[model samples]
Each structure stands twice: as structure tokens, then as C-alpha cells.
Target: MSPQEKTPATLPWLTDEFLQKILRDAGGHETTVVTSSDIKPMAGGGDNYLSTMYRVSVKTKDKEEAVSTISLVVKLPPSGAEMMKLIANSSAFLTEIKLLSDILPKMFSLLRETSPEEQEEFGAKCFYAKNTMPYVLIMEDLASKGFRMAERQKGLDLRHSIVVMRSLARYHATAIALHKRDPALVESFEENFYTDSRGFVSNATLPMLRSLAEVVRSWPGFGDDYRGRLLKRADTIYDDVMELMKPEGNAFNVLNHGDLWVNNMLFRYEEVTGEVRDVKFVDFQLCRYMSPGIDLQYFIHTSVAEEIRAERVGDLLREYHKTLCATLEDLRCADSIITFQELVDEYERKALFGFFVTTMILPILLSDPDTIFNPEQSHQKEDEAIVTKRISNIHFTTVLKRLLPIYAKKNFF
Candidate 1:
């Protein structure tokens, strides 16, 4: 039978029986019988490389009139065998399952206890999750609630950037509070995508760096010597990248939203002025315990426009540090672990990280879905070639050209 024609196995969490139980539990009415219908695929952000998402409409009632109708987004592992193999080889899927199922709830509960008045400002809530393979995470549909994704090509403007920075600060501070209250709980969080050698991102680093080196060789002013130096450096790029991801002396470490580009965040805007009011982060597959600079630098490089990054990066960092300090203070955690100066210093130390990740991800972020390869539609061999070509497109080259000199000037290479 063709791959499409073969009946796909139903994941345990996707069954109607499971949905009824969770829906009733969420509504706080155990006897309510929930019926789900119109299950359809949701267009996901390009970052969800190893999974697919579905929007499910659920009607809940207790043998009478409908009590309420709810929409939920269900994330499931990739169904294609090749894609499933990649996910199985990496830590991303399991890490996210643990994050949503175990860590986030505990962190949210602790935050509520420490700052009851501000409890509402915590992270996104997962309605239900099953950590086993054929993993599933059901979360409130942020899009239905008026949260929209930022444009990947245009990137985030100053106001949106501020909202996201504030949210990230609150998120990082929660980890700090949790660590202080119960160190053992956060012990396992240290092994993130970068730290795990078997993870997809870590394995992709060398090839991506080599691709960057190839791009550099074709630049106008670059010659053999420059290309040689870059190629030599590329040989050690993976190890260097991994080292940068490590926390330095217990100073500025926190549980970082390991992937923090524009596509991973959703913002709700004020309808009148079109100003950003609140933000929600999604796709925790890469969440890790690392220095805050990992997320900070990643977002700046991948999501902010060049002019905004060059002109206001210092201001943005200051804003992030201020919010982080306030959050830590509110949570009653030690605020002196890292000063603003130290944060800046750490950001500078890890500047190369932004360059590396941007080169690897910006193409996928900027390209349209039609232009990119779809593993579900294409053969594995053809998809590999298409992905390589997609990453080397004009959008990727343009951003690389814009960023190369900045990295050189900063001595980040």
C-alpha cells in the first residue's frame, strides 16, 4: 500500500475516549461528555521540523444543552518513517514532552505560590500531554485566542521585541526560582539540544558551519586565505558551539527557551493601535538549561532587523536585564547572581552562537512553504537535495552578507 493509503495507527491521546476525559477534567465537570469533531491539520511554524499539529474542535455537555465549545491544538510526532527516525535519534521530542508534562507545571505552581498576585502572567498552559512515543501535547489554541505570529521576513519591530523580551525574562526567572527552591527538580534539565551530542541540532552544526564557509568563499572580497581560515575554523565549530552553550561558573544560567526566533513566539495586539500587548512562546522541543544569552542572542540574530539590532541591541539587552531582575526579585530568588554588566559580558562572549544559528535557520524562516521541500510529499533522496538548495537561496545569502561583516568586526569568528 502507498504510504498515504496505509492506515495510520491512532495515537493513544488522540482517541475520542481520551479527549472526553481530558475535556471534562479541564472544564471541572467530570460527568460532562465531550465529543470532538472536525479534526484538521493546522499550519505550523516552520520550526516544527519533526512534528505535525492538528486543530480539534470539542463540544462539551452533560446529557443536555452544550456547555461550551473549545478549540485545542494537538501536536504529534511526524508520521513519515524517515522523519520519525530523525526525531527518535534526537532529544528534542522527549525533552519537550518532559518540559510540558513535568517541568512547566511544577514551575508554574511554584511561581503561583511565590507570587500569587502575578500568577496569571506565567507561561502557556498545556491541557494534556502523553510523553510516550506517538507523543501528543494538547494545548489551548493561542491563535483562536487572538495571538498571532510575527512575520518571519519582516521580523519583529521594537514594541513587539519589548513584549517578547519581557516574557522571556519572566520565563527565565521562574527557572531560577525553581532551582533555588528545589535544585534536584531541575537537575535533569541541563541536557538540552546542544548538550546532547545525539540531538538533531548538534549533529547539524558541522554541516551548517561548512555551508557558511562555502558561502564565505563566494563573497566579493574574500580570497583563498580568508576562506582557508574560515574552513579551518569550521572544523572546530561544533565543539566551539557546544562549549558556548555551557553555563559559566553558575552566574547567568537559567532554563532557556533554546529556540527563540520570531516564529516560536505569538503576540496579541491592541486592535486599535496595532500595538503588542501580550506574548506567548510555543515549541518547547528545544528548551534547555543554559545561560540566558543563548535565547537572547538567538532572538536578536534570527528575528530582529539589522538596523534594529545594530542601533538598539544594547537598549534591548538592558530592558531584558531589568525585567529579569524584577522577576527574580518578585519570585524571591537571589538577584545578585549576575549583574547587568555580567549579562552584557556573557552576551558578547557568546556572539558567535548567533552567527552560527542564524546561518543555519534564517533560510527556513524566510522561505515560503511552497519553495521548501516537504518530506511528507517527496522521496528522501530528493528531499535532501531540495533542503540544501532551499537553505542556499537568495534570502539566506542576503542575510549572511548583511551579518558577515558585523561578525568580523566584532571578532566573533
Candidate 2:
């Protein structure tokens, strides 16, 4: 088939007309062009399992220059009607579309106007989205800019954690500044999963909690008392988790990159020194307005290694608070509204937020793709059994042994 003849089935919302428009806008010229062959699927991390990603390379020729190539990453909702329906019913795709199309740009624009010096340092530049069904988002491909994903199994060390925390601070600070400048925009971020109870009661919730309980039961030193406590807690995990998800109604509230983890962030390193320098976050499907503690706890729990977390979680939280204060000051907001102590206290109170989230995703993070059960195939009885079995993989036991004690000591359980 010719390039112009490619249908939505092949490229979703991508069409020759939309391609030309994207190229022209990106290049700031009208002569840009591309072909179907220039678009190809790109390998993304686990978060991308719910969506489709593509790298589009277009050759553009200005009136006075030779042809040059422009690259963009196109993200679309999952193709299956059932999957799309589920996503639509939840806050997933709509939250992401609003974030990339509305909130981020407004925040960046405000940053440029108020804090021009730091404006260019934060966030990725997303291209305009058509914002129709099957939701397409075009953005600059970070890979072309030397950004790479951190390895999931290895987890992040102190330096990598610092980079992500600093970036996250800036992102959260922007939301605060945006709230100050445009409360309506920040208020609109309330349309997320946390605002509703349906997400906590989803089919995956009970099974995940049971798997977590089983892992706890299988731990070597786990006493019967603790195991019973964990199982009883599992029965109420959804309600407890929902309570943590509720808004704190404080000055510290900001828009969170609801799904913060190793896979959701990308980093650029210094070539010679091997030093981590820059970080950018992706996957805003779960973005929400909540206490910044939610993002902090979730990222540290799921992405940082247990050893690093054991020794340096306190330092890491301080570093994040430091950046958050500095960024808020830069944005002309009150840095003292949420003190460092308040942050620590908030984290302590909301620590179960991380525990619950970690239980759901840690197994997936540690498991290999071949061994992991396919969610799409779960309709089959055999596939359902496979998925149930895989959920109690040995990695869960290891993670539970390492983390449960810490959670208990902190009263997170």
C-alpha cells in the first residue's frame, strides 16, 4: 500500500494531512513531508503496555534549505476495544491527554513568563494533540536526545535517585506555582483515579492484595501473628488505600505524576564522567492532585533498592524537599507553606500508599517478560491460572522480606 493509502488500522489517527501538519509545526515551515515507511514502532517500558508508541521520522525541506529529518514519538490508546473501554472508564487516558495538552504547557508557559532562567530546564516539549478518540500524543523523542531508561532489575542508586527527585520537585513545584497563578488549571487535575472509589475496587485489586498476603505468608521469619495481621489487612487493603488517596486539603497539595517509578522516568548522563545530569518523566496516565508525599513514597518504594532505601531514604526525602523549596522560591511561591518536617510527617501518615502500590507492581517489575502472565490472555481459564500462579513468584517473597519490616517499623502496615 502507498503511504497516502495507509489507514487508521495501521497508524491509528495518523494521516498524511496530520503528519504534514505536525512536521510543519515542529519545523516552523510549510514544506515538511514524510512517508509511511518513516513511521515505526518503538520499544517502550512496562508502563507503555497500556498504550502504543511509535517513532516517526519525517524529512522536511524548508524553502531555502535541503531536506532535514525530524523525529517524534506518537502515543495512542491501546487498540483493543475492550482495553480502550476500560481505559476510558478509568482516569487513565483522559488524565494523560489533559496533562500533556493542558497542564504541562500552561505550567511551562507560566515558568517562561515568571522564571525564564529555569523554564527550559524542566519538563519535555510535547507537540499539539488532536485530542479526539483513540487519543494521539506527539512529542519529542528523548532517545534521540541521549536519554535512556534505568534498568528495572538493578533499580536506582543514590545518584540516579537524586536526579529523579530533583526533577520531580520541579514538576510538583510547577503545579504549585500554576495553582497560585491559575487555580482553575490546578483544580482541573482532580479528574483522576484517586478522586473516585471505582479504581480501588477494580478486579485487579483483590487478587493483587491476596498475592501480597501469600508472599508475606511464605516469608521465612514471618510469624503466624504477622501473617494473620497481613491477611486481615489485605481484606481491608482497598479501603485503607482509598483513604490514603483522599486529598489532604493542605497547601502541600500538588499535581502528582501518579505513576512514579524507574520505568516512568528517563535520564541523560555525562558521557565522560558517567554522571547523571538530567531527568524527564513520562506516563501521566495516573496524574492527580494530591499530597506530594504520594509521589515521593511511591518512587522511593518501587524504584530505589532496599539497601539504598534503608540507609538514605531520609536523606533522599530531604534532598527532594530542598529542591522543592528552591523551585518554589524560583517560581515566587511560599516555600515555607509545607516545611520539611511536614513532608516527613505526611510521608509517615501516607506510607501505606506506597505499600499498597508496591504490592501491586513490584512483582511485575522483578519478573521476566517470558515468565510474567499475559493480562490480555486472562480470559482463557488456563491463562487465568497461569497469571494467578505467576503473581506469587519468588521475587515477591524477597521484596516482602526486605520491605515489610521497614513498613512495620514505620507503622505503614
Candidate 3:
């Protein structure tokens, strides 16, 4: 096929016309000419499982001969037709597209009205978004602006965690304020990782539990009874998880960045001092309206470095709650702030969810990044060697050893 004839399979929304439109939108340029455009697909793993990102570098010149390079990222549903169909049927990607375009703007406007001078930008600037099938998102390239992801294996430390928690506090607080303004605004954010039409999570979690139980059984200290308890929990795991996400007894709730792990967040550091400057959250595809505790517990355990997590967990939660109350006060939602005791109670209730999530992702995170695992088929492939191998990997083994005992004492597993 001719270069002009090639289609990015109903995707590749970055066409000549789109290039002109986004440029006009991004820079407010009256007229711009695209001299050349280079599009490169992002490498797999770490970002999330639901979409693909393409980095587009466009060289443009105006009528005045002033030239500039515009760096953008184009995000699309999975390239596989089956995976695309599944996500398209669910509200995951649709929720994110709508969020970046419509909802986050309202939230940001609240921030501007309340605390403009203090907070940095909340997320990547969206130049354009289309919510229909094979949806597309075009936003500024964060990396070009000096943002980099924290090393997933190494994890975030105290300073990094403080910055991140502050951002999350602002995010959840703004969401609560917005929700109070319009109750229906959050109706669309009700679906999450388990809402796949094909029962993927149910299929995937059971096998993962069985595998985890087997490995624990092989460990030096854990006995058969421990394995039995682990396996027994699998019987009601899905229902148990879904229940935690629902509003609990009039407790405060806000939207959750459902997959809140290290890879989904990015940090920018000061150029001279190397101190962390700000935080930005990406990948809201799995977001749902749930307790902020879910995000807190998951981030504390799975993303923070172990020593910091052990020594300063209380300090971290205090930072989050203090910021939460402060931001709520800015928005006049101080009445919505949970008490310190209540915050700790809520986080403890959601701690099991964090454990399950950490157990669920550790293998994938520890595995070779070169090997991309497909979430769509992960459920039915019980016999796959990667699952077993990753379960037994020494890195995974060490984490599970510490994790299972800790969670078990809390009656989480």
C-alpha cells in the first residue's frame, strides 16, 4: 500500500488535519505549517494494560518563518481487536477520555479558584480527545518537560512519597468538592479493573491465588494450613473486593485512581538541587469512585520503598490527611475531612485490597519488561509457565514472604 493509503487501523488519529488542529489549539497559532512529523510507539509495560501510546514529534513553521518542535503523545485503545472490543464495551477507556477532556477541567477550575498559586498542573495538558470507539487522546509530552517515572523496582522514598501524597490529597479532595457540587458527575466513574465483560479478573485472580498459595506452602515457615486459608479466601474473593469499593456507611468517598502504583505516577525534579518538585497522575482508565483509602493503602505498600514504609508509614498517612484536610478547607469542604482516627481506620479496612493488589502485580512488575503480558488472555492461561516462574522468582518470593505473614496477621488473607 502507498504511504498515503496506509491506515493505522482506524487509529493513528494524528493525521495532517489533526496536526493542524492541535497545533492551533495548543499554541493558539493563527496558521501553522507542519514541515515534518515523526511518530514513534512507546515501549510496552509499566504504563498500564489498556492502551498504547505514540510519541509524536512535529516540526512546524509559521508564515513568519519561526519554527518550533511540538512534542505530543497520542494514546489509543489496545491494537488487538479483541482487547479493543472488550475495553470499548466497558467504561474504562471511555471514562478516562471523558475525564481528561471534561471532568478534570472542572476540577482544575476549582483549584484555580481556590489555590492557583500553590499547586502545579494536575496532569498532562490535553490538546484533544475523542471518546468514541478506537478513542484517541493527544496531550503534551511530559518527558519533554522534564518529568520521569520513579523506578518501579526501587520504589519512592520519604520526600517523593510526601510530594505524591499531597497530589493525591488534592486530587481526591477536589473530586469530593466537585461531587458535592454535582452528584451525577461521578456516575460514570463506577467501573474498574474487574468490570471486563469477559470476567477476566475473576478468572485471573483465582489462578493467581492458587499459584500464590502453592508457593507459600513451599516456603520454610508457612504450613499446609496457611495454604488452605489462602485457597479458601479465593472462594469469595471477587465479591469481597467489589463490596469494599461500594460506599460504606456514609463514610467520605471520592474518585480513586484504581491502578495507583509507581508506574502510573510521574515525578519532576528541580534541575539544580535534584529535589522533587511536583507530581502528576496518569492512567485513570481504571478509576472508580471509592474511598481515598484504597489509593493510600496501595501506594504505601506497593510503591514506597520498604524501609520508609516500615519506619514512616504513620508520618506518610499524617501528611496525606493533613493535606487532605487543608485542601478540603481551601474548597470549603472541611466538614468532609475524615478525622485522623477515622483515616487510619479506613486505611486499615482497605489494607487487604492493597495486599491483594500487590500480590496481583508483583510478578508482572518483577518479570522481564521485555515480555509484555496481555491482561485479556491472562485469566484462561493457567498452564502458562510465566505465571509459575514469576510466582517462584526469588524477588517475588522474598516479597511474598514478608507480605503474606503481615497481611495474614491482619486477617487480610
Candidate 4:
């Protein structure tokens, strides 16, 4: 197909005709372009699309009551055919938008009724949905109010950490309560929106993992036994990482923000006064149904510093468990809460999962000029290969130092 004919399936909502219609429908004169300056590309947690943000200024009949200074974040479809093919196979692309729509009601209710403190703790406000096809999210432009988080300059402080922990607890608690209160509603929602059956990291990642493992084995200064153990266990490790689905048996699986790193949250602020306000979670692209460990592991290891991680790892886990239990209790969902014992047990069974996420994520987190910055010139895939090769060693050592003893103490092989 010609380049012009290479339609983006994800953005069915955007078209020249549609923009004219929206402009006409708004009954505004000329719809002053206001100079569509490109919003700076944000970091990480995306596989497809070159995301750009634009601000539009317009006047309407309800000027006294209307909200002006509308903002929108446009995600154009992937550019290269190769890249598009890669995206076509990965579920993260369209699933993120679909999942957002499914969970929007619960989010809206939480935002509307919850206290400011409670809102900070358990609410996500989705102001509007612009699903025209190849979806365009003309959202509550947070930047208009100066409510945005600067990228990780330092670790999450104790107060903020606790707030984030509590917020996560409330989010998971609501899901469990919903499940218990109305199983069919939860099931129906899950049915409508669930994980993609395939991910590039699943079908295409194992080979890369195996190649990286081999490269590590060949590197100098590596001991014989270290090489042997990693290679021998490579298959098992790859299997576990790629097949990071819901655990079988009695584990309580809930909705997890599959990529819950620190940057995903936008800190709400009082624009005029320049005061810090509430935390609004953004980027639901990687949300999924999985063990809570997946979310907790990604959040703690990636967001917190090593020293802080060491000091507060157990404390934070305990805090998360307690908050989770209390929220369940408040919702009359005590029976559904994953027990402290079970929580610890799952941690043991899945601490290795942290390594997988840390390695997979660090590239996007640490790399400069993210994937969307300049698609043609960037070497994200190459840089990712190097990081993957090195992270396996770092991840193994991290396991040996932090997770191994715990595994041995619990005798969970």
C-alpha cells in the first residue's frame, strides 16, 4: 500500500473531515489554530506510536461558563512498516485504550466521591473520551494547570512512597471488592478488556534472552560455575519471564498497572499559586491482570534507589499488605484479601520476576531520546540489546544478593 494509504488502525477517530465536523459542531468562528506546537515527548512505557501533544484555543457561546484552553495528546501510528509489524503483533498498542475505557466508570466514581486525600490515594479521573477510531484522547490537559511530574531526579521520599503505596492498595482493593460484590460485572469487564494473547517480549523475546545469556557466558572474568548455572537455567528463566501470566491455583489475581514506574503519575498542582497538589496516574497502556507481585516488584525496584530499596523493601511490602487488607475489610471483602502469608509466599515464588521487569524497563527509563523522539535515527533496539545482555548479569547478581537468601530461607527452589 502507498504511504498515504497506510492507515493507522488505532486512530480511527482522527481525520480532516472529523476535525472540521468537531470544529463546526462546536459552533465556533475560525477555530483559531493557536499554533499547534508539538508537546515534548514524554518518557517510556510505550511500544508503538510516535506520541505528540498539541494545545488548541477556541471560543464558544458559553464563554462565561465554558472551559477554554483545551489540550490533546495525539499518538500517530508507527512509521516504518517493520515497526508497524512489530506493533501489530504486540497487544500493548490498542489494548491500553480499550482497558482505559473499560475501567473509566470506576475511575470516574472514585474521583467524584473520594476526599482529596482519598482521591490522591485511590482515584484516576478520565475527563473525556474521544474514540473516533485510531483513537485520539483529548483529555483534561494536565499541563495547562502545571500538574506534571519531573522525571526521576531522586527516589520517592518516605511520605510520597507511603502515599503511593496506599493509593495502589486502594486501587487493588476496589477490584477485589467489585469481584466479590458482583462477580458478573467484573467478569464481563475482564472479558471485554484483557491481556493480548501475544507480546513481542513473549514470542520474540526468548531468543534475544538466550542470545544475551550466551554473550554473557562468553565474556571474560566470568567464573565457570556462574556461566554453567545461568546457561543451564536460561530456558527456565526465559519461560518464567515471557510467560508472566496469572499464577495457577489459589493466588488472588487483580488488575495491575503492568508498568507502574514513578513517571507514570502526573502530580496535580494549583497552577496559579504554583502549589503541589494531588497525584493523577496517567498512561494505562501496560495495565493487565496478574499477580500483585508484578506491580509491586516493578514499582519498588525501579522507582526506589538501592539504599532506600534495601531499607524499606520489607517495610513497604508489609505496608502494602496491611493497607490491602484494611481496604478489603472496609469493603466487606476480608475473605478476598490475599493473606499476609500468601503474599510472602507469592513473593518468594516470584521475586525473580523483578529482575525481568528491571531489565526490560531500565532501557526506556534510563535511555536518552526515547523511542518516540526520532524514530529513524534512534538505536533503541540496539541499546536495548546491550542493556539486556548486561542486565542478565546484574539481575543474576541481584538475585544472588537479595532474592537468593530469601529463597533459600524459605526453601522455595
Candidate 5:
């Protein structure tokens, strides 16, 4: 399918004809055609640019052979309008897909070859095919897994959290390994991912701040004094946030599932016993390398509640670094000097981001879905414009409140 064919609204990229060609290329008979392509909206998939689907296919090599079933999730990239890239950025949208295609399989292989005990710890089995824009990621569907994080209140438990921490730690450790083992391979991958997206984040976010200021004004608990504090903080702290968008801080500079929240995780479980089986990390559109603490802090702050997070942040950070140390030791890599204390320091520095987002972003995000997701329900001419402005204000203010104390205490800046 052409790049134009894919949009955030609907993925026309996963048409039957195109899938048939892919199956044919997978060493199946030419006559092995997709008899049916069932496309259905997947729940809890709102944070991405693509229209995600749990696809069920009926395929037949010949009339005599029983039509085989193929279950997968088809991910199409965001439309050009949905994403605004840098001017000099040439096919950066496409380049991200290629990066994932290159990195994920290598990651999977390491899990299988080096860390078999941690195999089930990671997410889906993913393979990519380039449409006109290098789009379309076909992956194992976790529908039957019965783990859904749609509700804002529900999130990863202690068990799931530990596993994800280990997996993420190992992921970064292995990337370091790859760089040491084959600097050429690492360099090539880095080249494709070379563009800095901080500009987009900075430019695109100002309007949201204004919108958030308005929302704070209207909300019941926020008084004029409180709103002023929030707004003042928003203006000052926003610059710091934008700074994070830039590529810096080696501790933060690990490839990350950019939106590593609960919704992106799918868990398998026993049908009768209702016991959990496996957790798969899905969605790669927002995947980028950044402060490794961001994902963990983001997930912990946004997914878990204040009470739980306050209690467990230190423990979780500890687990993450310990796992990293263990994984690097196993790989016999010498670059594993990061310690639990260092991780805690990183958390203290970055965990403020979690507080900022959870307090500001979650309120509206957890608001009634019809108001948030449906255009028809919007009374404003451009609901997104309104939402964006308000959220940004809230984000900036909230971030400032959380950051000032921490930044001052650490005297980092």
C-alpha cells in the first residue's frame, strides 16, 4: 500500500491484496491467498498515531488444504498531517520504522540466545514490511492473553513491573554490547536515528500550555492563587522539559518504548485459573532513545497511583539497576558500572516528570472518553486546540512545582 493510503484514522495499508503478497513472500505457495481480512479496532490503543487492529486471517494454499489461520496486529504509521517532522528531516517517519525493524529482531535474538530465562520477560514477536513509507509492523496479538490496561486506575502489578524493569535493563545493556561487538552496525543504526526531535516537542507544546491554564481556571479545586503558581511554574519549567527533548544525558540515552505506559502492555493468562502467563510490549511509533529513567518513571508515575509509587519508586529503581548489573555480568561486558545508588539519583532527578504528567495529563486523559476522544461531543470549534492549550498549562505548572524543589536540592541547575 502507498504511504498516502495509511492514516491515523484508518489503516488502508493492511489491505487483503498486500497481505497476500507478504504471505507469498514468506515461502508460502502463490496460490496461498488471504481468503478474508478482518479488521477490528483494538481497545486501549489511543496513545499512538496509527489505527491499530487485531487481525484474523483465513489463508488457503489450495482448495483441498484447510485454510490456515493467522493472527496478528497490523500497525500503520501516523499520517503526515498527524505528525509534523523537522524541515530538513528526510523521511524520518519512515526511518523510525526501519530502526525498529533493525533493532527489535536483534533484541529478540539476544533474549533467546543469551537470556533464555528472560525470554518470556519481553514483549511481542515483531516483524516488519515496508509499504510505500516503510510502514506496517506485524506482531503477535495478545487479545487472548486477557491482560488489558484500558482503565486508567489499573496498571502493572509488582510482578509485571519487575519483569519489565529487568527487560528494559537488559535491552540497554545489550545495546551497549552491540555497540562494543559491532560498532559499525551500531553506527549505521544511529545514523538512521540521527535527527533531533526536541524542536518539534518545544514548538508544538506552547499552545498546549495555554490550553492547560484555561483548564486549571475552570477546574473546581484550583483557586486564582494556585492557578497563578501553576502558570508561573509552567512558563519557567517548560524550558527544562523542552531541554529533555534534546539528545543528552547518557543515563537517559537508551532506546525506549517512548510511550511505555500500561496500555501498551498486554498480558497472557490461564483461561480457567486466571493466572498471568506473559506480558508483551506493543506499539513502536513513539519508540526513541532517551533518558532510560523516563520510561520507568513515566510508567510508575502515570500508571501506578501516588500511594503505591511513593512507596515503591526506590525499590523499582533498585531492581532496574540490579537487573542491569546481572545482565551485563552474564554478557561479560565491562561497561556495567551503574549502581543502585546512581539509579536512585537518576530517579530523583527524572521522577519529577512522572509527577508532572500524572497530575496534569492524567486528569483530562482520565476524563470521560466521549469528551476526550469524540469530535462530535466537542462544543469548541477545535477541541484539540482547547485540550492542547489546557494540558500544556497544567503540564508546565505541575512540572515546575515538582522540579524546582528537586532541582534546587540537587543544585543541578
Candidate 6:
């Protein structure tokens, strides 16, 4: 039997023809034969909850050319009908495939015309994609290109974060430039963050907040008054956060990477200097058109190191805006961008969005990798309580303790 006939449940779509397509699309290579192939499930943790991933290695040979190997990462929507109901209602996987196939290429076109000499490439190269049912997205395995994810536990320091700030500004600038060219650029993301996205967002967030609140109530130095504040907030947090996430009238908006945390980004280092030279953001499922503050606040609070973040968050915002303005100027979109003061004003108004998201993100971010809990497996009430308790590691509690007082003073809790 051929490889296609011998396909296992794990790799239902790995046919010889599919390998040919991946090689041809990823690069301009046409192959005549598939010589070897290997596929394996990628290790999962808190970061891999929404989808399943497999790393593929395939070797192909053209009659005229020597054998060549292609490394790829294939992403499939979560398995099982129940998981489908949870994720499909949000339309997240389709959103990501759309962004990769339709929008990003347009953004890259604008970049090439406006700033041809720039080195950084926009998001990863999608070699193969199926947009219908049983959808699959195959992309270049960035790890093979010397790009790697940063350690979630350690978080990003100043230099690393500056690299992110600059790259993010350029990406945002290209997007703004494109949006101006076509005002309907945001039409596809209309159902994003707050619109009819209640199922997963509400189902996932509210319970996590309640669980965190329970653990907070158990902490020693946390007084009942302070703990009660969070407990009360949890009752209405779904509405509270959704309200904050929506863009106000006449707001300066761009595409927000809704889940902008450490794991969603990968860094490429300069070989000799060992300096982080480039960053490629992953997980476009959450990308949406909204106030840039949504992305900024989520990133600063959840991804930046606590030491650099405590006193210098303002500085970081200024840095981000400065770079944003400069890139906008290059893209000729400066006239459409928000002023630095305006961005700071918006950031303040959205501070609670950060506080709420950070509380949920930190626990998983700082949790022991070996102890990562599967969200899909926590359907039971008791399992959820246990997951939340385990997620509240010493680091998780310390980070929250330090920030809670600050948030309280701001009257956020």
C-alpha cells in the first residue's frame, strides 16, 4: 500500500501529493518523488491548548535535482466534536488561516513598496492551507531557521523587549498603511474580541477569575477587604473586561494581537553578538482590529519582566510609541496615527484590561513546565479548582501581590 493508504489517525492528510505541494509552495522546488518522511506530535502545555501541532520532516527528489528535505509544522483545529464546539464557535482557527492567507500578504506588499531595504519579514510563510472543514495549515518550521521561543518562566528583559517594541511598531505601521488604502481592511475581523464571541471568551475567562479569587482569599497577608474586592470583581468580570476591550468612538485603532504574551512570540538571535535581532509573532487566531492599547497593555503586563516592568512601564510605552511613530512616518501613515500623549491616555483607561488578563496569564506562564495542566481536561468543577490552585505557584502569587496594591490604588479592583 502507498503512504496515503497507510495514513494513521494522527496524520490523516499526509499523502505523497501533499508533501509535493508543501515543498513546491514553501519554496519553488518541484519534486518527482518522496523518499522519506517522519511526523511526530509536538509537546504540549498551557500554550498548546487551542490546537494540536505536529512537526514534519519530508525528503523529496526531483529527477533533475538532488534529494531535498523540507521541515514544516502542521496545525489542525482541536480534535473531537466537543472540542470543536468550544473552539469553532469562536471561529479562531478560521481567523488565523484568513489572516495568514489574505491579510499578511497585503501587508508585506505595502512593506516591500514602501520600505524595500528593511530586513524583517512579516509573520511566518504558510506553505499549505485548507480553509474548509477538516482545515489544516502547514507552515515553515521556524525552529529550523534558528528561531526559538523565549523561556516563559524567565520573561523578557529590557533589550529583548525593545526589539519586540520596534518590530511590533513596524508590523502595526504596515497594517495601518494598508487599512488606509482600503478602509474595509477590518471587515473580516468584525466578529473578533467582543462581537458574538461570548462562548469561548466568557466560558474560559469567568471561571478562571473565580478560581484565582478563591486562591487569593487563601493567601496570608491578603486581608478580607482586599481579597473581597477581587471576589466581587469576579462576579461581573466578563462584562467588565469586554466593556474595556471594545474600542471607543474616534479611537486610534490597529490590529491588536489579542493574546500578546511570551509564548506567542519567537526570537531570532544574531549568531556572534547573541543579541535578539528579530521577533516573529505566532498565534494570529486572536489578531483583531482594535485599539493598539489592547496589544500594548497585554504585552507589558504579561510578557515584560517584573523588574523592568515595575517602574519603567511608562518608559516602555513611550519607547513603543516613539518607534510606532517613526515606522508610521516611513509608511506614510503618520497622518493617521495616534499621538504619544494620546496613546498614554488610552493605555491608562485600559489598565484594568491588563490587570485582569495578567492575573490569568501569570499563573500558567510561571508554572513549572512539567506541571502544566490541560485546560481541555478541566471540565469538572473540582478539576478546575485543582488546576487553578496548582497554577497559583509562589511566583504567580508574588507577582499578583506586588501588582494588586497598585491596581487597588487605581481603584481597579
Q: Give one digit per residue, the lDDT tens place, for model 6 in 1-413.
A: 57755555767569767787667665667545777777878755766767888888877888886877778889987785656666666667778898888788888888778776865676788887888767788888888888898887777999889888887877777888888888687645765634456654555555656677677676676667776787788777667877777755578878776777888888999999999888998878888777788888888888888888787887787778888888888788768768778989988888888887766555655667655755554443436645576557766666687887788898877
Clashing pairs in 3: none
Model 6, residue 391: C-alpha shift (Å): 4.7
Which of candidates 1 and 4 is the stronger one according to TM-score?
A: 1
How badly does each model clash, as a count of residue pairs?
0, 0, 0, 9, 14, 0
**Full ranking by TM-score:** 3, 6, 2, 1, 5, 4
For all predicted structures, in order, the TM-scores are 0.87, 0.89, 0.93, 0.69, 0.73, 0.92
TM-score of predicted model 4?
A: 0.69
Per-residue C-alpha lDDT of model 3 across residues 160-216, encoded as one tens digit per residue? 999988899889999999998987877557667665543766665567677777778
Model 2 lDDT, residue 14, Cα: 68
Model 2, span 1-413: residue lDDT tens: 65546544557446656777766775565665554336787764344556778887766665666776767788887766656765566667777778877788887776787675655444456776756676777888788888888887677999999888888988888888888777777777775654442543335445555555654575577666566666677667777776776667654688889878888888998999989988888888788787888888889878887678778988898888898888788778864457889889988777888787666667666656554534443333333444456565664555667777877776655
Backbone clash pairs for candidate 1 read: none
Positional deviation of residue 368's Cα in model 4 after best superposition, in angstroms: 4.4
Q: Rate the local accuracy (lDDT) of all candidates.
A: 0.72, 0.71, 0.78, 0.52, 0.55, 0.75
lDDT of 5 by residue, 214-306 (tens): 555655555464456556655555556545534463443566665666666666667898765556676554555556776776677666544
Clashes of 5: 14
> What 10-residue stretch in candidate 1 is worst by lDDT?
1-10
lDDT value for model 5: 0.55
Measured on C-alpha atoms, candidate 6 has an lDDT of 0.75
Between 1 and 3, whose lDDT is larger? 3
Instruction: Report the CA-based lDDT of candidate 1 relative to the real structure.
Output: 0.72
